[model samples]
Structure formats: C-alpha cells, structure tokens
Target: MLNKDCHHNCNQGNCPFAQDSNNANRYVCLKCGVEREINRYPSGFGSIVMLLLSLFIASQLLINWEKQDNQPQSEPAISSLR
Candidate 1:
C-alpha cells in the first residue's frame, strides 16, 4: 500500500494524492516520500505510443523520399524571352 498526501495546490480537481496544506497545495508520494507534480497520463503508455508513432511516420517519409529519388528529373521548359 502506498501513502500519498496532497497539499491542495492542484487545480485539476479530484487528485488521488493531494491533501490541504494550510494555504498552499503540494503533492507527496507516500511510497517514495517524494513530492512533485502528477501527470495527467501514465508515463509508460505515453512513451510507447509516441515511439511507435514516430517510427511509423519516419518509415513512411523514408519510403516517399526513396521513391522520389529513383524517379528521373525532367528538364525545365525554355522561355522564348531568354
């Protein structure tokens, strides 16, 4: 079991680890005895999703670049004014 204290500084409401600390709000992790801001999303899932998305996007971009490079460039049309 982890013990947590909330100092009531969080405006997000319904914080699981917040307690009223007189006039100021602070967060304390009961398990580790560390005080800090809590993130809205869990770190593990967010990091994994971001990593996969980046890899997919990068691969798509690389494929497009390779296709473009393999294509021959056409000469520009000559202007009569030149």
Candidate 2:
C-alpha cells in the first residue's frame, strides 16, 4: 500500500508506503526501492488527552495563584500579658 509514486529511499512522512498494512509481511519497499519497510506514524489520541489534562491542571493552579494574590494578608493579633 505504500508503493505509490516513490522512486528513492525516502523515509519521510511523505513516503507513500508508510501506512501499508497488508505489506507487513513484505520486507521490501515498493515505493522508494528500499529493502527496509516504511515507517508509519502512530495515532496521537493518547498524547492529546495527556496534554489536555495537563492544561486543565495548570489553569487550575493559575486560578488559585490569582485568588491568593488578591486576598489580603492578615497580621497576627498580640496577646495580653498574663
């Protein structure tokens, strides 16, 4: 499946044979004339989810920081001598 219009052994993402599933059995690349199998990019959903979770935590921290900054500081009250 990665054998579409390839001439050289280009291992870039633009390589046509990167996502060829049925070719998993094949050791040769049809596109770039290489004996190596084309590399494929994996799904990104996991990384995206992690990124969103981190962003949410960071925003919560920022909000808390702002609240603390806006609150007035109070001094300790003096106790009367016994």
lDDT, candidate 1, 1-82, per-residue tens: 2323535533333334544375234576443444554465567988999999999999999999999999999999988985
The deviation in Å at residue 2 for candidate 2 is 23
Worst 10 residues of 2 by lDDT: 34-43
* C-alpha RMSD (angstroms) for model 1: 9.2
Q: What is the lDDT of candidate 1?
A: 0.63
lDDT of each: 0.63, 0.64
Q: At residue 34, what lDDT does model 1 achieve?
A: 47
Q: Quick one: how many clashes does candidate 2 have?
A: 2
Candidate 2 local accuracy as lDDT?
A: 0.64
